[model samples]
Target: MKVDPGTLDWKDAYKLLIGSVLPRPIAFVSTVDRDGHCNLAPFSFFTGICANPMMVCFAPMIRGTDGKKKDTLSNIEATKQFVINIVGEKIAAKMNDCAIEYPPEVDEFVQTGLTKIPCEFVKPPRVKECDVHLECTLHEIVTFGDHPGAGSLVIGRVVYLHVLDELFENGKINSEKLRPIGRMAGQTYTRAVSDTFELERKKQPGK
Candidate 1:
């Protein structure tokens, strides 16, 4: 059925988007405020944007309850740096703990008992539990609106990468070993390493 977004409420729009998106990659983002307070959170609206400059982006929507920016967004705005930690099955529970709406001063790493280690290029620490981490500097932030459910696309350029040795093979990540997880709608998640299949891409018609 064809549905008009303009007629739907913000909550309905969010539900539709998440329901159809199908297992979005979660950016377990870590950031620090100007005063050096640490914050960790997750954003499912995350993906790689450009390979040339190694850019990635995540959208942090305004809170539907309060219409205020998340701590991750505010921290990034203040320090212009963050680290995107890949969420694996092993750390899924702790990552879920971070999704709570904590006050700005609260540290999810400490709250969840996750290990935080220093990064080389960025001020924000990395989640040691994750197999991969992308240390990034803020490239830009494009806000869509000020109301609730509005998203700000936070573009970041990866300056450094940290990957588990066992997960890296032949210059590529071993998905089976990494066992990454993806966000699904309403308290659901999908495992990337389960029931996987592969197919060869077809060559260009004339080539």
Candidate 2:
């Protein structure tokens, strides 16, 4: 069935998008507000954007319930820094716990019992349980709209990186060791490195 997004309700559009997107990588982002209160949340609409300067981006949609910015977005806007912790199967449940809509004053680390370790260049702390962490400074925020379900693409440039030594080998991360988890529609999640396949890139003819 074909449907025009322009004619669809926002909630319906959201449902369609999430359902069709397959499994998306989860960005377990941590940030600190102006008062140094820490906030952690997960965003499934997240991905790597560029490699030259090492950049990534995530979309923190406006809260449908209150039509306001999420605490994560607000903290990022206030501090201009954040840490994106890669979600692994080990910490998946704790990561899920952080998805709850907690008050701005709530420290998710304390709420979820996740360890918060200080970053090298950013104020936001990293999740000690996460195998990899990307410490970034804000590159830009591109807002799609002001209404509920609207997304603000927060582009960040990675300034510091922390990776578990066991997961890195030969200049590449060991997928099996990382055991990353991803977000599916609704209350579902996926194991990203499970049931994998490999395909070599085809070289151009007469190159």
Candidate 3:
């Protein structure tokens, strides 16, 4: 179907985007409020930006119900710190449990029965259940719009990383051991370790 995104409402556009995206890597982000209350949530609109500065980004769209920023975004804004916990099949359900729209004072770690480990360089804690964690310092937050469903892109620089030794093979991570989970349309998820394939990039002419 040929659809003009500009002609569609934000909700419809979002629906189309999510439905067609197939599967997206989820960023299970944890942040701390000014009072030290820890918040955890999952965002599918997340990706790595660059390797040199070790930057990553995620989009925290405005809450659909209230048209306001999410508690995660608020906490990141205040604390200037967040940890992107890699979601694996083992903790996928627990991560989903934290996705509920809890209040600012709510500690998702307690609510979801997840353990919070102290971060090395950030105020926010990391999920001990996660095999990999990227402790980040807030680099910037760029807002797209003021209306509902609008998103704020949060860019952060990785200050520290924690990875399970078993998940690392040689100089690269073992995807099969990691068994990462990804987001699908609606209440569905996909596993990265299942049905995998590889392709070598084409080489250019040597000088």
Candidate 4:
């Protein structure tokens, strides 16, 4: 069925957009207020953007009920820094708990019972439970549209990367060891297990 995006409600548009988007990598973001109260939240609309400068991007959508921004965005704007913690199946429940709508003064790190470790470069703390963490500085914040429901695209430049010993060997990261989890449509998720295939590009004849 054909539907006009302009006529559709935000929830309807979100449903269609997320369902068709398939598996999305999650960024369990961590940021702190000026007083040092840490906040943790997950965003499915996240991915790495560049290699030379090592940039990452995540879209923190407006709250469906109030059409207001989330705490993660507020903290980033105030502190100008945050950490991206890779989530795994083991930490999914805790991650979901942090997604709850609590008062701005409430500390998510304490509420979720997650250890908040100090970052070397950023003021925000990193999730000690997460296998891999990227400490980043705020690069830019872009608004999608005029509506309050419009997304805020937060771009960060990677400053420090913390990797657990077991998840890394040589120079590459082991997906199975990392066992990172990704968000799927609806209330589902997927784990990075087993082997991944690779295809080598072929040249037309030999030079």
- lDDT (Cα, tens digit) per residue for candidate 2, span 59-166: 999999899999999999999999999999999889989988888999999999999999999999999999999999999999999899688999999999999999
- Which tens-of-lDDT digit does each residue in 114-134 have in candidate 3? 998898999888899999999
What stretches of model 2 exceed 4 Å from their correct place? none
Per-residue alpha-carbon lDDT of model 1 for 1-207, expressed as tens digits?
Answer: 789987899899889999998789999999999999899999999999988899999999998878899899999999999999999999999999999999999999999999999999999999999999999999999999989978899999999999999988999999888899988898999998788898999998999
Which parts of model 4 have CA positions greater than 4 angstroms off?
Answer: 146-148, 194-196, 201-207
Model 3: C-alpha RMSD to truth?
Answer: 1.2
TM-score of every candidate relative to the true structure: 0.98, 0.98, 0.96, 0.93
lDDT of each: 0.93, 0.93, 0.92, 0.89
What's model 3's lDDT at 48? 95
RMSD of 1: 0.8
lDDT, candidate 1, residue 17? Answer: 91
Tens digit per residue, CA lDDT, model 4, 38-125: 8899999999999879999999988876778888998999999999999987899999898899987888889989998888999888
* Stretches > 4 Å off in candidate 3: 205-207
In Å, residue 157's CA in model 1 sits off its true spot by 0.2
Better of 2 and 4 by TM-score: 2
Which stretches in model 1 have alpha-carbon errors above 4 Å? Answer: none
